[model samples]
Target: MTVAPRIAIDAMGGDDGLPVMIEGAARALGEDPALRFLLVGDEAALAAALSARPALAAATEIRAAADVIAGSDKPSQAIRRARTSSMGLAIDAVKGGAADAAVSGGNTGALMAMAKLALRTMSGIDRPALAALLPTLGDNDLVMLDLGANTECDANNLVEFAVMGAAYARAVMGLAAPRVRLLNIGVEELKGTDEVRDAAALLRGATDLPLRFDGFIEADRLGRGEADVIVSDGFTGNIALKSVEGTARFITDLLRRAFTSSLRSKAGFVLSRPAFHMLKTHLDPNNHNGAVFLGLNGVVVKSHGGADAGGVANAIGVAAKLVRADIARRIADDLAHFRAGPRTAVAAK
Candidate 1:
């Protein structure tokens, strides 16, 4: 019989605190009956929260953690108290084989640092990257990576990101062979920096991989679903992500103002209410809530700190999907196939 995936949760990590985290878990459990949880937090508080949700309580086991890492804490400082903190313990659960994956809505830097130290990178992976799914104009979502994990990336790192990101796309997006591209200023071969150009050359020459390398894709074409996976350095990826978010909000606010400007506009909005509702739902960040740390020995998903129950549930869902899909193993196999040689190996930092 197949075993159900167990997820460890850092209940006390996010801005909304335990209530939202527990509720999100409950929602996820309700959606996936085979899933189980290890909720890490103060025993008394967790017991109180669990008492209210009998169904979630039934599928969950409370694991006591003595401390909570503050959002403002630095990664260096947070790593020292790794054992006692809720986030640390949750990640430990994964390393210890107690859980299939770990989920947290905590300080990103601290979580990344703790996870890397505890789990380490898989063989053939130099660094673990942060990857997240973004809404696209097409029916499927785009898989973009290095969402702030490593600020800068070398050509080798970008090539690895492409491989890992494509694996992620297959697992989560259910594409057999995802189209891969580098985020470039222009689509032309000569437009990007040396690292990007080098990475492109390497990917183009890479054979026997499951993904299709489509070369460079411009930022504006991202939403058009030109590629299934987009790879870049963390600095560029983070800025581009924030820019898209800001633009989404701007368009949403502009529509709201336009609809409320006068009675005629209000009537038109009412007439087109269904279309607007679809647009709103499509643009909502909660639907695409998880930022996965790829290349780690085990799966780690980072939810937005301010995410509500729905957002948290979505993040948990992403973790569950990856676990079921066996993303890490697939990535390892692909990496071994695509970049096999003495020179491909890099010493871990």
Candidate 2:
């Protein structure tokens, strides 16, 4: 009999405390009945929270964590406290074979440091990437990587990200052959840094991989919904991700202000309420709450720190999908094939 995936959660990681964490776990359990949780935090607090929801409490196994990692804690400092902290314990559960995956809504830097130090990168992976799906105008969401993990990356790293991102796309997005692209200054062949250009060249030559390389793509076209997987160094990727998020918020805020500006505007808003609701849903960060650290030896999903129960549940959903799909194995297999070297088949000709 196949066993259900058990997830280890950092019960004290996020901006919100115990109640939100427990409620989120309950919500996720409600969605996926087969999922079991290993909640790591203050045992007494967890027990009290779980008492009201006996169903979640029964499905959960609470582990004691004496400390919580602060949002301002540096990665180096967080690493030192890994043994007793809630985030640390949750990751430890995954490492020790108690859980299939770990989820935390904590300091991104600290989480990366702890997860890397604990789980280590998969074989042939130099650095693990933080990948998240972004809203797009097309039928499917776009997968962008290295959101804030490795500030600088080489050609080989970008190539590796493409392979891992493609596997991730298949696992989460259900895309059999995801179209991959590098974030660049221009779509032209001569654009971007040496690393970006070289990675593009390498990807163009590797048609054997289970992905379709679509060459370079300008950052401006990221949300047009054409590309499936986008690769970039963490420095550039983080900036782009923030810019996109800021733009979304600006638009949303502007819309709200305009709608409430006057009686006429309010009437107009009511007339187009359904369309506005769709737009609001599309721009909701909670809808895209999970960011996975790809290329890790095991699965570790990072939830937005300010996420609500619904957002936390969505993040858990991302982790569950990865565990069920055996995404780590798929990435390992792809890396093995890719490391064997690409054929001399450059589509750029």
Candidate 3:
């Protein structure tokens, strides 16, 4: 963590293909020139592509991995091919200490399976949660999980998530004591299911923990700046994430239509161009492109397959930041404290 991270890039895993992935690495280097990469994919193709990117080529080493995990491949099937796949080797680089972290735009299920198998969950974590940062109107971005990792979770899982999430916020966002909330039907204590209510009770009693646990938060208030960490089962979290994304797209599209409806509207758009540009930047998925698999022994970031070069660079940046901060050790300490009994655990300053 004291020096620049050496990252392992799954170069053949994205939809836009190798070009965007390579360009993303180059872009990341342009921002932080201390980065180095272990590019895993076809040897000839990688060599040919990097020939055009002199700086990236100079900072990278190619590791030929001939196989690729298809987007349509199931995790069960893909797990068997881990030894030969590009995504697999990238993760392997992290497990083997050849790299500080791994970044891939490959199949999520496959990546999760391979990472869990290779890196294993941390000592106190039962399962690894998929967590990502969402742009909020608050002082800093919000961290939300499980985002489709655990379809169903008990009260224990929920509490564990809150601990992991709060640790993530503190380590990566530099929050001393983040406000944690359960994703529920309403802010009322009794409004959600039994599991949510039980989790809330546990969190409220956990004063010795590092976070400030509120009662509950409704999905509509996700971006309202009310909470710092949001926890939920994967099913609900995934739906809420998609709903937010869809709403952003709908609003942007609606504005596009309205702006072109008449000459006056077009002129109004021209006058309001700067505001619209800011709006676009806020709504763009590329700006929030990295989703980390929390609780693993090593850091592995999941990039959206449809991400452009900018998006991939942002994902790589997320991975690099996590590496530089030693997020894994931070989460492990919190998890260990949680596993030991809250009454015995001391609040983090």
After superposing candidate 3 on the true structure, give the runs of residues whose Cα lies further than 4 Å from its correct spot: 343-349
lDDT scores of the candidates, listed in order? 0.92, 0.91, 0.90
Tens-digit lDDT track for model 1 on 295-341? 99999999999999999999999999999988889889999887663
Give the TM-score of each candidate: 0.95, 0.96, 0.95
Worst 10 residues of 2 by lDDT: 340-349
Better of 1 and 2 by TM-score: 2
Question: Where does candidate 1 clash, by residue pair?
Answer: none
Off by over 4 Å in 2: 1-3, 344-349
Error of 1 at 307 (Å): 1.3
All-Cα superposition RMSD per candidate: 2.6, 2.2, 2.7
Residue 270 of model 2 has an lDDT of 97
Residue-wise lDDT of candidate 2 within 271-342, one digit each (tens)? 999998898788788898999999998999999999999989999999999999898899998877776655
